[model samples]
Target: MGNCGSSASSEIHDIDYGHERVVYYEEADEVQKVGSVYSQPGSKGLNQDAGILYQGYGEENGAFCGVFDGHGKNGHIVSKLVRNRLPSLLLNQRNTLAKAITGERADGDLFQSKQVIKWKEACTSSFKLVDKEIKLLDNLDCSCSGTTAVAVVKQGDGLLIANLGDSRAVLGATTEDGIMAVQLTTDFKPELPCKLLLLYIQFLFVA
Candidate 1:
């Protein structure tokens, strides 16, 4: 894990598992910028948290950011796998959806609606594909190990956010009083009603 600054001329920045890099937009050096990410290892001696920040992602002024939290044994591997592959998979899905709608009338509300639907579909498809890929890994044991993923994609003025498991995404908005934090996604935890119901069903079958 290493840290490097972004150049003023470039809008794109990338950070991987082992190699860490940060990009700041303003002239003054500040940790908090348009493209910045931070991750630290736990007391277990291995960093189970992984993240990515890509500026100029799908188009100019576009960005993609994700944070994954690993749990159980061999979870770090799973988190890294998702972090590395999910972005490309999502982009491909988005592109395919865009191509399919090329001839359609994309203006005003219709265009916005279609874009939202496509992005939601793309995120869903990409996540499923990543899960399948992880399951197919012969060298990895994921029976009791998994990772939570939370990602946000920005294209022009539109923002598409997706979450799986307990990871979260929050948006900081400038309010009249001060900066307000707006949660973008819900954390899917076992304490939720749906999860509790599923657990009860499983326990009944077991008993």
Candidate 2:
């Protein structure tokens, strides 16, 4: 008799993973700036990654701009919201600030759709707009399902960065000093050694 402890063997099977079939549509406009989006493997939605670039001008200001990156499950949604809403919010904020100063809500009236306004004023307005929008998001419970948001504003040759999570933005400049790379955003997760190994296993046996 054969060993009682021995187990019977069946046939072996092979499988093929065709992940290359996935195609994501990315939108970009270059006349003013650049924009791109891509989803990682773990992304459960259309895109787990999102980014944006905005340009603004005023009377005493020129070209004030920003880049925002949103990362997480809802990264794509938040990113889309900010890209569409942030610039408009900034425009309104600028109007509010100008009014705050001169006591006239529409003093400079940059949104008249006429002449270009100053860059500094435009940029300043943008900053206030983004902050207000973020606060609006805070009123609701945005933590359990949250995303990383990093922003950058151009200030002359210098850039200002506001960060909440990981997606990074690096400033590259070449001058008399040479090539220098300045990192703008920092990751929100503190545990560097341990990575979040999220596994989505699907076992299907068609008979």
**Clash totals for all models, in order?**
0, 9
Task: Give the runs in model 2 whose Cα sits over 4 Å from its true position.
Answer: 1-46, 57-72, 102-143, 155-158, 175-178, 191-207
30-97: candidate 2 lDDT, tens digit per residue: 22332222223344434434444333332322222333344555554555566556555655655555
RMSD to the true structure for each prediction, in A, is 9.0, 19.0
The runs of at least 3 residues in candidate 1 whose Cα sits more than 4 Å from the true structure, single-residue gaps closed, are: 1-34, 193-207
Whole-model Cα lDDT of every candidate shown, in order: 0.69, 0.40
For this target, which candidate reaches the highest TM-score against the unseen true structure? 1
Error of 2 at 172 (Å): 1.2
Backbone clash pairs for candidate 2 read 58-117, 58-118, 59-117, 59-118, 60-118, 61-118, 61-119, 61-120, 62-119
Q: C-alpha displacement of 192 in model 1, angstroms? A: 1.6
Give lDDT tens digits, candidate 1, residues 8-34. 434334444453322222222322335
Question: Per-residue lDDT for 151 in model 2?
Answer: 52
